[model samples]
Target chain A: MAEKKVYEKTLGVMPDVISGFCPGCMHGTVHKLVGEVVQELGMLDKLVRVEGVGCCGLGQQFVSHDVIIAAHGRACAVATGVKRCSPESLVYTYQGDGDLASIGLDETVSAANRGENFTVIFINNGIYGMTGGQMAPTTLIGMKATTAPFGRKVEEHGYPMHVCELLSQLKTPQFLVRTAVDTPQNVIKTRKYIKQAFQNQIDGKGFSLVEVVTSCPTNWGYTAKEALTFLREKMFEEFPLGVYRDKDKEEA
Target chain B: MAERVFMKGCEAIAEAGVRAGCRFFAGYPITPQNEIPEYFARRMPEVGGVFVQGESEVASVNMLYGAAATGTPAMSSSSSCGISLYSEGVSYCASARLPVVYVNVQRGGPGIGAIQPAQQDYLQATKASGNGGFRMIVLAPATVQECVDMVYEAFELAQRDNNPVLVLTDGVIGTMMEPVVLPPMKTDEDIKAMKAKFADKACTGHEPCKQHFCFPGSVGTGQEIANKEAEKMYATWDKDVRVEKYLTDDAEIIFAAYGISARISRAVVKQLRAEGIKAGMIRPITVSPFPYEAFSSLDFNQVKGILDVEMSIPAQMRWDIDHAVQGRCPINECRRSGGQLLTNDQVLEGARQLIKEVL
Candidate 1:
């Protein structure tokens, strides 16, 4: 028998195109995971992707769905609009830490609190990757960023935000999970968490958020390998990987 | 058949929105315009529409952007400070060419000015609504009826132009009560059909569609191309320029105004005409596609001078009047600001003074 093809690129993705993200940025991986999940769930035709600022905004170019780019940090609000207006469509916002936790904190919290029936795929890479490695809301203490030259200090800059933890406290969000994409196992687990978030939306279970701990090698001033190690060793310490809230599992 | 009901200006505008098939509303509470959202909160659900009292003006406008991107008739309203916060989202809407409707119930301002009715935001509404020099189709309504009517028509104009439209009223019109014949409510099927018609081009997740919706950087050549397209769209809006001319054919002096100021100016014209003064009024219903043509058509040789009446000190509409008159006639301004209403007598006195200057 002829060899059978097992794995192929997702039909929800544009083929063989270079995104505007920096080299080795995990935004591409997250985008791929999202595209694959959408394709697997037979939601390719029903996916409305709302893009935010920073490198994650480039997901609009790579995703083969209807994508609307929002103003900086306004993706969650925009996604809320899309989902509410077209309830049959699966709408998701792809945002960076700066876009979600910084300028968009109010929108993020408000959407979660409203229990908006949509999915949020938050990429937390500890630094602002698009504007040349500036400090982000998720940036770890002692992390070196352009905006934090002296390295982040708890007294000066405050501690890095734990978005999953913060959002999980809200009663409205149906699912809230924190996952990383640094290793093979972690990447698979991250994909699973993201799929579950999308599935929650499909099931009409109001807001679900998957926070992906990502590596920004170019922004972090490290090689791809070093960045992966840093994500596992340092970043994971501040943002531990686990499901913070699962309404279905909790009820069961 | 539509029923006549005495409704507040803000409530009427909200009713008009629902009647026009506006299925999505997201707004923040602001003085003078709070009734808009409050009305929508009760009425939208009744019509099977979505209503979200957003976290802030910023969030509400962006939410409108999201809903409008799906080609849903979405609207938002705010007062001056709140409108300022919506600027960024408005620009995004323009960049994306989404037909969104917004209302700014004008109030005294340069900052957190008084909440009293004022026309201080004329320049902001007409000239620079948002960054990148995008112009919205700004409608100035002088009456509660016009407010309801304009808010009803604004959705069509917005959809026709594929841009955001602003219904600019003052706190007076927003809070005042009047009998208005509301338009018939849009049936659910009509709204669905409209959505289906736009689903192909809209970012509503329908398949066999364009991959990208409307992001400046994501599109070809970034915002430069999108902006160029927007400029082209703006050039075609000359056909939409609207103005109401009263007794200007044989008049020697013309009073230029809009919104509440225009309402006051109309009364002033009637009073001046009764007093045997050759006074006429030119009211711009669409302030952005301003009545420049109206000024140009006037027999400048026969005209004595143009008096610009406004509720803002130092005048904001005067610039458009000056541009329209183009030195053909001397222009004088009669204005009040800081939430002070311009009385008809004040306008009458100012017009008499301008007539004296030209005579």
Candidate 2:
């Protein structure tokens, strides 16, 4: 009898090691997508991850690849180092919002502005998860955070940072997409876009960043199911999901 | 011996780095060290290397941090305030055991004190303490020629220990023009050989190297053990402690100095000896693993006083000297600060006063 297989774990996921991400977090989904993409592209042996600081760095426990954790927000600069020296190595930076948008904005902006040939898997949850629900740079307007006890105010905390839009202003990045994994369909799309981003690097295209709009259920004060609803209802409204930059399509 | 060239101190250090197989350099421009990035910007392309003028010192050092992870021979240079920004990246490299060389072409500091030469960063450079109290072997080059030699060898020393090494130079050596015989340039094959050695640890995507390296290395599991190993590593640096004991064996008054301050002390020692004061100098070439041995080994009865000379207000290196001396002899300081260069005449006068009191 032939057994039908519906789901199987990717070998790209480290064997038997539990991730440090909180339960029901979409970080687990994103990590799975990254691993699947690398394995699908046959780049598992050549892939080098520049791990960011913050929750996104939890992939280290689960992803099977050579990685070097960059000091908070410096992953892009580190990826640039690896890519520039070994052009054949498939280099990517897995960064969280605070690491990419706030403290490491200079490094992020510079690496993308230079159009360094690399992939950036940016996980944009609205709050700081590892640090106990502090306000991240991407925290939405009026969203309550530990730093913003009364919720974010226009006069005080400023509006949420639109990372994809901000990076879109630069001309170098070849593929820029905002995708998510809360829904089954969105998870499929995230895999496709991530594959495209990694493909962009494999094709020797310029910078590619797949910003995954995800949920931090633990930090958002919601259960796993409610967080998915929050992603669909609130997160999608503040940060609309779409491909902001596609150099090939624009040229086409 | 490689060919000799008349070059500025900053350019010489850059050339020495390139010749030592450093194919990647990232640094932000600051006083007394701009020539370094400028030289790399001009020179790197010819060697198929990468040179980045980082938007900030933090970014520059982080770039080196990433590049060094792939087993690339990497170096960064900055002056006083700029190096402070590098403290974060330096700490990461030390913990990750990335062998990257750094040069602090120091200028007056303590919150942007001055643009001219000073040694106010003595404690900072030796402390190299970014976070977690990690220490690096800090090499202090006293001359432009020594700057080239020390920076050329620093990459090797850094790789030998699998740790970061700092070459601490000041404005006098960083900007001074001097004739230096450069080390032989490393070939492409040499660089390949150097990188092949780190195959086990580097993020080069080789099949054998499959693990990620996090700071504190063992991540959450074995950090205390890792910290203890780092503590043990510091003990191994005693052999790398470099200090020049100049006529200190039989002197009545000893001058303790480093970098440009040491040069002045050397000239003052000669002038003082000619005047029959029995003055000698002990210059620390490597300031981190400081030559406390120089003071402890001294015949304290013959040494009437230890004069710590520097271009800093409250002599920073005196802490090490005091520890070495163990209160055996009275320690006096001849200091010129706030961008002032210590004059040989001024140091000689200070030595004479010490001689009167001690000798």
Candidate 3:
């Protein structure tokens, strides 16, 4: 009997380099999904990934692709430049909650509004991971962070940003979805969303974004197992997973 | 030779950039330089290029960064306050070695002081364009014709150094209309070949998707070494120093000026020469890698004094002149600030006063 192959290495990520993400962090998982999408699409040679400043910038270290590390909060604008110049090359920006929802909000909205032919993978972790857990724009009202030691207040910090909901209001973006990677079942769903975002760009369908509601175990102060549990119980309650917009399926 | 056509400096600059194979431009609306983006919007599509009126000056420069990284000649144009916004992205471009070009049609400012015209951004242009001790080759053009030529050459200089270059004109030069013989527009093939040269390091997807990249914003030996390498590269820019040394061979008083101020200074030189005072002018076309050698080489014994004529209060270019003159001759300035244009008679009187003090 011939041995069956169940798993194989993907060259989308560099071989043998350990990721520096803290344990229980979803950056590695999301990165793995992106790497899988890159390989599955046969775009390992022509993918230009623009990584925003923050934990997402670590994509430069292990992503085996043409990479541009954009200045803090400027990845969307940078990706716009790359996509406009090399229309044939696949381009995307990887950004975190703070990088996308706060400092980079204008770039995020403008790129999506223009319907730029590219992809955006937004990791909404509710806290600034690389900066050691400052409250992010997407942080829940009662969530505690280094900056909000006593937990966020409704009057002081305001409400969390629902990126999928906010961007869905735009008429241009071809695809917009919210997903998670906290459970094996959700992880499979997350991969599908990521793949669809890539396929949107490949089909020249214009801007597509997948907002992943992830957890930063180090910053959230939880063990890997407990973090997944917390993400399932707490994070899911705030940012429920679903497709926010799909231009292809919408009435033309 | 191309036919000479009368055009505004800003329009000439836009056309020159397109002709030089600059395929991408992203800029925001700013006073005294609005025509630049307006022209690009109408022209880029015709030339098979792109134009983006970005969300802000900050986003526009970052867009230039992304476009430039792919080996495409990219540019952005702005005025005083807008260039301040461009500083961060400009610094990033320098560190990343992404060749990019920008134009600053300066208007007066400590804080949007006035919109007409002023040379107050001289120090800002040459000394501290941005953080991280990064430097750019700043070009100052006095006329619409020269503006066209400098803009044409700026892309090549940027590509050669793999660094950012600035065309420092003024509201006077940017808005004023003059006859310019434009360079031939670059063909589609020429632009493609230019980008192909940067294919190796450019972020364009080449199969295998290989890249080793890092941003320098930390305290480490790697950044230190990169800074040192930048310093060595800046040192070689001395060869690219451009200054218009006019009749300094037998002059008693020399006028040091640039841009519109330099244009005025030339008339002052002739007016003084008519009166037999033997005045000459040294104009810096390339303000950064400033032609200090032009000043240091002057026979100080024969030269009575050097007058700094400018449109700023403290004479911003004085810093470079001080370094060049090195106390050999007294450096006094005839300057008008806050959008005030210097008159030829006013500068001639200042030159006479300087000559009296030195003699």
Candidate 4:
């Protein structure tokens, strides 16, 4: 009973229910962060979330806020529309690696370039979680998946897209930070940055992104605990974590 | 009162959107309909509005969905291939029942099939372009002037029904220049009057409205509220189907067409009248609520033959006409596809052939 009570407080506004995500999924952790931020900011009434296809696609379903499910690879564009149309509504998008990096690259870069006033929570879990472990754009070089059984060869398949570095080139996008939630200490920092991104929108600042370096235990062929160690050791080396852009401080 | 001016069909559509009190325009440029964005790029700013050249058609319609979600009269324009990219947003708008206007300047399809005009997207525009059992009110205009005129009706019907409305014009109607009269522009005072009465529809939290009167929690779980909303959409579509009839009182054959093809059919009707043969044309302005009753009102006993003028090889609209007639008259289809438009001469020749075979 005490353990249940402790977990209850952490969820904030996330309803307690069985979700489509696999057990011990990092999506649950990210959703909790999103819900806590919404509750803390008092934006539950005005929140308009656009969810895309993936494991995190179901993030909106767990939260107690107004939500709109966008077509795959189109969440950012939809959120851009929503924000421009209702400048007052707090708009955000929850997308996965495949939806953001591969199919919706144009929408992502352009929205960032134009400085669309919205928040984007990108879940980068190496493999495509929803469609069975396919080769994602972020699939580490020489990593095996269903599509790339031998491994993602750098010479043949090209290098993984450094979306953070690509987005950092854009002059706009007020806040862009990449963080991981594998550790409890890192999870707290991830929550802080995610909240700050939404707060930037509330402050009428431009586009903000919180790219979460998450885990795919089921697809990555590892136990949930081992996946956390994999992210810390293998993934962080390839995609480093930290703030890529902070325009507010840059101007100062 | 209607004012007349020589204008390209695409320009007329942009101008009509303005007259209809559309304050938001988001679109990406595509062939055969690029003029629409250019027109709005200049005109929207002049009218104290926002015009975004979206990164892509997907972005544009999502932008449209955003604007429409706020109850603003918003629209996007695209040619055939670009319109295909907008299908996802269209489906969401349908599910949400968000009122928006989409202008598809029809071009050849299957994948960027030339920039020339064609009526290949008839089925796509009329059927549910989105998910579930959702439908869009498709308005097919026959002329540049009607492109402007029908857009106004499209906006009106969409808002009144709280559903998405499509203005289906071919590349011919979009590119061809013709004389048109712009509707009277709404003044600041007019907007103020509308705002005073209907401001709640635009944004929430107006004077702390009751929870029951707010945004719906999900899609289709509510009872009386959802039913009442759906009933309003259905009733509005039923009443807004517009059709034009020509010389149908004592005609032996009737021609069915819409958009650019309808214009050609009208010319064929005139030629048949001159040749001492009784022929008429029935033009459907609203393709979705399809004026079945309007076409059925024609005396089929006297109508010995029917011809469908189309720009598709498979005879799309002719199917609708056949359903309307219910095997009452001998029907034939005359069509040209892959970016080819039927000429007045070609349509008349088809009519003449049909008349000889039947009469």
Candidate 3 chain B has its poorest 10 consecutive residues by lDDT at B209-218
lDDT of 4 by residue, A55-81 (tens): 766665455555566667877887776
TM-score, candidate 3, chain B alone: 0.97
Lowest-lDDT window of 10 residues in candidate 2 chain B?
B207-216
What is residue B322's positional error in candidate 3, in angstroms? Answer: 0.6
DockQ of 2: 0.64
Question: What is the per-residue lDDT of model 1 for residues B1-359, given as tens digits with 9 covering 90 to 100?
Answer: 76999999999999999999999999998898999999999998787889999999999999999988887989999999899999999988887788889999999988989899999888989898888888889999999999989998898888787889999999999999999999877787877876766665688675523464766433457667777778898899889899999999888989898888888888888888898988898999999889789998889788999999999987998988888788988999999998999998898899889988996
Top DockQ: which candidate number? Answer: 1
In candidate 2, what are the lDDT values of residues B1-359, reduced to their tens digit? 56989999999999999999999999887988899999999999999899988888888888898888888999999998998988889988888888999998888878887889989888888875588788889999887889889998999998888889999999889998998999898999989989988767878674422565545356565867877888899998888888898987678889999999989899989988888768889999889899989889998878899889998988899999998989998999999887899998999888878888876
- On lDDT, the candidate that comes out on top is 3
Pitting candidate 1 against candidate 2, the one with the higher TM-score is 2
For candidate 1, list the clashing residue pairs, or say none.
none
- How much is A131 displaced in model 4, in angstroms? 3.3
TM-score of every model? 0.96, 0.97, 0.97, 0.88
Candidate 1 regions with alpha-carbon error over 4 angstroms:
B207-212, B216-222
Chain B TM-score for candidate 4 = 0.91
The CA lDDT of each predicted structure is 0.88, 0.87, 0.89, 0.81
Q: Write the per-residue lDDT of candidate 3 for residues A150-195, one digit (tens) a residue.
A: 9999899899989999998898999999998877998899899889
Tell me what TM-score chain A of model 3 achieves.
0.97
On TM-score, the stronger of 1 and 4 is: 1
